[model samples]
Target chain A: DTAVSQTPKYLVTQMGNDKSIKCEQNLGHDTMYWYKQDSKKFLKIMFSYNNKELIINETVPNRFSPKSPDKAHLNLHINSLELGDSAVYFCASSQGAGNNEKLFFGSGTQLSVL
Target chain B: AQKVTQAQTEISVVEKEDVTLDCVYETRDTTYYLFWYKQPPSGELVFLIRRNSFDEQNEISGRYSWNFQKSTSSFNFTITASQVVDSAVYFCAPSAAGNKLTFGGGTRVLVKP
Candidate 1:
């Protein structure tokens, strides 16, 4: 069984379009995160939620929003996407929001804004 | 801000040879976690190993080994008797007070027969 999974593994949308990527974790973890991997393969954390509470919010644009309805799910919604947003979005989860813990990552959602 | 650096962008080795991937991290937190993840052509991030600030003992798992040194703030991974299947991009990640993770640019490993 997959511990973490993301839907719409590949997303190709036009500029100014809005899209949402869904992520779900079955590991019964309390924390979920969204990370963006740019073309240069540099992974950066965008947002993190612990038990439905916002924890870490990086300097991401307002167009990028993350919503966690529950501890097991964290979804990312991008509004008016731009070409620069084209990259791989990964979903990760951990046992808690504490430090020194390893995260379990999903297969990732490849988003390409044309 | 915490950052992880993988100095070697790419490394090539012959099958059955040994290769070491270097990772250096910078963080102010006294306690943090270091991790190594592998992403092959399949594109899925596979968790290889995790080391905390308290554990500095070198760990050897089969053909893979990790060395963690707190003084130098380095966590290195080595693969002994590497096979062609080991060809992949390896990433070093660091986590601090929160669940957020900062990953390095990654080191692409190519194993040739």
Candidate 2:
């Protein structure tokens, strides 16, 4: 069974379109996170949700919002996508959202805005 | 701010050869966690190992070994008798607090047969 899964493995939209990527974890983890990898291959954290509560929100724009319906699911919604937003978006989950617990990542969603 | 750096962006080696990937980290907090993840061509991130700041002892598992030195803030991974299946992009990460993870630029390994 897959531990963490993200839907819409590939997303292609226009510059002003809005889209959402959904993530789910069968590991029964309490915390889920979103990460963005740019063309330079630098991975950066976008958001984190612990027990469906927002724990960390990086310097991402307001157009980017994360919704965690429950502990098992966290979805990312992006509005007014731009050319620079084309990158890989990964979703990960951990047990307690603590320091020691390691994260299990999904296959990632490749978003392209033209 | 915590940061992780992997100096070698790409590496190529013959099958059955040994390779070492270097990772250097910087963090203000005294306690933190270091991790290594492998992403295959399929683009799925695979968890390899994780070590905390307090533990500096070296660990080995089968063909994989990790050397952690707190003094130099370095966590290096060594693969022995590497196979073609081992070719992938390796990422080094460090987390000081919370659930956010700061990942290095990633090192791409290509094992030639």
Instruction: Calculate DockQ per candidate and list them.
Output: 0.79, 0.82
For model 1, report DockQ.
0.79
For the candidates in turn, chain A alone yields TM-scores of 0.98, 0.98
Quality class of the docking in candidate 1, CAPRI style? medium
lDDT of 1 at A95: 91
Clashing pairs for predicted structure model 2, backbone only: none
RMSD of each: 1.1, 0.9
* Residue B98, model 1, lDDT: 82
Off by over 4 Å in 1: none
What overall lDDT goes with each candidate model?
0.92, 0.92
Clashing pairs in 1: none
10 residues in a row with least lDDT, candidate 2 chain B: B93-102
Model 1 lDDT tens row, A13-75 = 999999999999999999999999998888899999999999999999999999998899999
